[model samples]
Target: MMNDEQKTDKKQRLIRKGKKVQEPVNTQLVVNIFEGFTKDERDLTQAHMGAEYFRVMAWIKEEDEQETIGVRSFRGFHQFNERLVFPLDCSSYKYIYIELIKVHSRRDPATSKGTVVMGRAKIRLPPWTSRGKFTSKFNLVGLNSDRCVEIKGYLNLSMQLHRYLER
Candidate 1:
């Protein structure tokens, strides 16, 4: 019933409203990862850092095709700071796309906490999805008082990472 121009205008207005509701990063939490790694293990981290996008797909018990709940994108990789953060506005989805632009790791056996890490992560939004930032923590676990961390554990944690976005 609407003309092409009117329909386009309506779509644009919806996108603008969604962007207004999106939030960016503000608070942060630091976590410690534990596991021993060899030189080969350290080199493997090179593959973890890059630019990737993750869309949150709904998990259901029935054997039916699940729907996409929402989506988020991030540019990730290993770094001195080892920090990757998403905007507060991107909290609606449970999963995110991690894209690594650059990544590196080290074989140094060092054990410490509260080390400052800096890295950039981006969240991609569909034309209809809202824009915003959400605050979340990178959880970790370690064994004994070792300096090197197990790479498998870190990768697994990211795979199981979930976000509860606010309404």
Candidate 2:
């Protein structure tokens, strides 16, 4: 009969042979939100009357249990060049949801205090792209689905997936 040591060695060999080897993956997702512009200057100006600042929130759509990937605040109505970074794990989630909120200086009678959602945009990860670097532009909308913002606004964004180290 084989000794305990011999049995252990055989078990170890079988375990090693059965286990599938995988390389370590280290990747980062970088997002740059560059600019915001509006054609309806009058409407844009009116909207900014009680606006204190703007806040941007990001999260993964799949595992959205009130958890956020990142949050940023900019103190202006225009020209916000914000940068956000997160770990890149495509298998964990499929899409990233970005929301832009307008923080008012004072509470309006019509609405409650604090921040109000002005618009939102979604970034869909392409399955074919390996490099994972791209630029996109989106239009901002209002609360009412049919009643879009009278202002014709554009939001510029750039997203990249960079590989850092591998083992």
Candidate 3:
């Protein structure tokens, strides 16, 4: 995470080869968001009680690359095999913050508000310093008043990091 001072200085550029360049991204982070599994204890507990539409929002910490997946109906496993590629300025980012968003509906009479962010999770970047892949399931976390993390359901995906290559 970058401090306030570093964030304020957007002019900071990295030297690639031997020339100074000003691009927001010096590295690229590839995220393949596949599915979401429920941790329900009872049958149809999480299966039936779902919304009309579902989406996902993810962002890198220091890189500040945020994106949202296309709207899709919630079928079994919250199925959405989306490949999201994010350009990162540096490798300062360590975690990919995930937000399961509930898209708003105007046609539904019961609807009252805009998109709502539901379960959330943090995918830790792999320990590898260079290009590599980390694939697994991560549980959603809830933060309380004490700033504690409580593991919730699961978000299945894969993350890969690659440094910019010269042409």
Ranking by lDDT: 3, 2, 1
**Ranked candidates (TM-score, high to low):** 3, 2, 1
> Which ranges of candidate 3 are over 4 A from the true structure?
1-25, 38-51, 62-65, 71-76, 105-112, 143-150
lDDT leader: 3
List model 3 lDDT by residue over 76-167, tens digit each: 26777888887766556677778876676333336566554546876777654756788898877655436666554677888887666645
lDDT of 1 by residue, 1-167 (tens): 99999999898888888476544334211111111111133344555433322221112112322322212223322222222333333334433332121112222325243121122122232222333333333322232226543322122112222244444
User: Stretches of candidate 2 above 4 Å error?
Assistant: 1-22, 38-51, 61-77, 107-112, 126-129, 145-152
lDDT of 2 by residue, 2-121 (tens): 999999989877888968745576766677877754333334445544334555666664443122222333333455677777676655656778766655534343566665666666
Scanning candidate 2 in windows of ten residues, the lowest lDDT window is: 65-74
Clashes of 1: 32
Q: Candidate 1's C-alpha lDDT?
A: 0.29
Against the unseen true structure, what C-alpha lDDT does each candidate score? 0.29, 0.60, 0.65
